[model samples]
Target: MSALKLAIVGGASTYTPELIDGFARLRDTLPIGELVLIDPAADRLELIAALARRIFARQGHHATVTTTTDTTTGVHDADAVLLQLRVGGQAARDKDETWPLECGCVGQETTGAGGLAKALRTVPVVLDIAERVRAANPHAWIVDFTNPVGIVTRALQSAGHKAVGLCNVAIGFQRKFATHLGVDPELVRLDHVGLNHLTWERGVTLLDTPDATTGTEVLPRLLTEHGQAIAADLHLPLPVIQRLGVVPSYYLRYFYQHDQVVKELQDKGSRAAEVAAIEKQLLELYADPALDTKPELLGQRGGAFYSEAAVQLIASLLGTDHRTTVQVVNTRNDGILPFLPDDAVIEVPATVDATGVRPLPQRPLEPLYAGLIASVTAYEHLALDAALHGGRDRVFDALLAHPLIGQIDLADHLTDRLLAHNRHHLNWA
Candidate 1:
């Protein structure tokens, strides 16, 4: 069998080592022959190249290492491409975070108005990369790790490429809950279904175990029977969990911001400081040697949280495993939300094997939640149309779908901003 060739794009310095180690561990099953590293930053790419080479050398893996600032060269002939690109870094992220907050809207980088802004900035880049990937290696599977994943994945799918957006938040919560419950992660199966950055842990099950029970049945019992002691026993950071609270998988803070999560996002909260420090360090890491050595974490429990969901997809494609877990993947909506634009990009349960990914049909979301996702999907469509069609009306449509911007002012605001900020890119007739 020919060796698998993997391409890593963007923040290659931070994400490459973990992927190198991930593939290294899979040598027995899926041996890699090449690691193609792509990043616009030459120095960061060089350091990553050195680390990958050293790691492979130490592990005695003969994975050939290649580095490039050029996308075409790096992605050419690749079997699987893992992309983690960010447009403008923290400064851009800060804008995404602060701008919406200023608008009295939910200040999130991955959803709503902020997400629309990010999609506007990032969709063009993603499409260009997808085009290159298609031209270079039409057979390659693009595993996108970019934010606004739902929107980006939709764009790639629209452009007609095999692609899936990957995120770690849901998986991290599953692992954390499993650990607290003293269950093996692989044994503790969960049903995490929703869009990117917003998900609910629908259920958790112990697969094929003799004493298996439904999460709904088991969880309430666990919480009632042993809430306080369980918190003490597990030493969990979520003290609220000691009081029978079910932690919704992603953006727990936003949902509980008025209560339990208020502290987590506050200045005194560990999470807020953690995010701040990491952002600061990332800004200076390129110039300073000290931050380069600082470990990079992709999930809640450090590197473990960022395990390649792509590997599961690859394994499924090869049919090497009987079962695998993946989160936030999109497929045809066969009823997860009956009214939410049946074609909307929804995160949900997927079963994969040699045949392909089969998104499990799920119960329809309640009217309110379904409507929220529908509204967001509307903006998603308009954003893509604006990017591909480059019309002023499409930009207005994108803003119109947003709840924060009413139809009355949508065109005016979009026009003023489009003229002022996106003048060169906007198409006016």
Candidate 2:
């Protein structure tokens, strides 16, 4: 097979090296001839590109790494363009993680009022980039890794762009389950269902092999054996997982234990602040000519196993792997979740291949999970609307619809604070 060309739109991100590491290590899965790192931050872009090239060289991979600030130029003729954007960067995220505390809500980048703020700031920019990618290479697939992925991906697909959203949550669970089962990670398949971030692993199947179609259901055994360990990892009690007979995404804590989480968030510095500090250290490390490998500190920067998830998704989408694989992705519901509208973007296990992603059929969800999923799905629709056509009223409506901020008074306060904190990023604010 001829080598493919790939692009990373937010290549200046500290996350770039993790991706580079994946491309270098998984060269057989997805061969690339050229990689264009596109970002407006020229200085950081060059630093990341230089490190990326060194990483490729260290791994004996011959891919040429390039950098550009122009989206069209960077994405030209690309087979796949990965979006890892942060519209207003960490400074905006710091506010997203803080201001919502005033309303006694969980302040997070990908949920609640803070997530709505991020969507409003991010959707327009991503749409513009997607248009440029479409203009340059209409056949190229857009793999979105941006946060509040459900909404952003909905925007991309609603605009009729060929796009899918990828997240590490499912893959992270797979790895953990694999370790517990003492099997290879590839042998573990999760019945991961629900919207992005708001998902639960209803089942864990131990496949006969990496490519096997049949497997033994091991969720009951997993809960019986590693329940405490798993619960500790999620920071939720074992009873919660046992009571539901499923492991909820760690993000669910923002909803399940909203008040407690708010107090914890209020008492601590924002995750954005912590990541900003890590990025600083990472950049310093990247600047080292001798540093060809991703530093240890990068592990703590989050998005664990993202590179593997991304490479697998891109490889499958481009047909480079030539094998049908089931991976959890955010794509159009299209009736996968009977409770959601067909157009709503959902994060669930799906079969990915060159033809595109088709969400796997799922068993019915009980009202406990279904109710929240329906509520958040509604908020996501309104959030996309507010992102597409910016206005204070639309923003308030989205916040009001969010399960975490359903109260009128809290939504009002959050709406004003969100607008105030993000006015510079929102054109119509």
Which structure among the candidates has the greatest TM-score? 2
In the range 244-317, model 1's lDDT, one tens digit per residue, is 24435445345344233333323333332355566445445434433323245333223354545556666555
Off by over 4 Å in 2: none
The digit string of per-residue lDDT tens for model 2 on 1-429 reads 799999999999999999999999999999999999999999999999999999999999999999999998999999999999999899999999998887788889999988998999999999999999999999999999998899999999999999999999999999999999999999999999999999999999999988898899999999999999999999998997998999999999998999989988989979999999999999999999999999989999999999999999999999999999999999999998887899999999899999999999999998999999999999999999999998889998999999888988888899899989998888897
Runs of candidate 1 exceeding 4 Å displacement: 11-13, 209-217, 222-247, 252-304, 318-328, 334-336, 391-393, 404-429
Alpha-carbon lDDT of model 2: 0.94
Q: Which residue pairs show collisions in model 1? A: none
TM-score of each: 0.79, 0.99
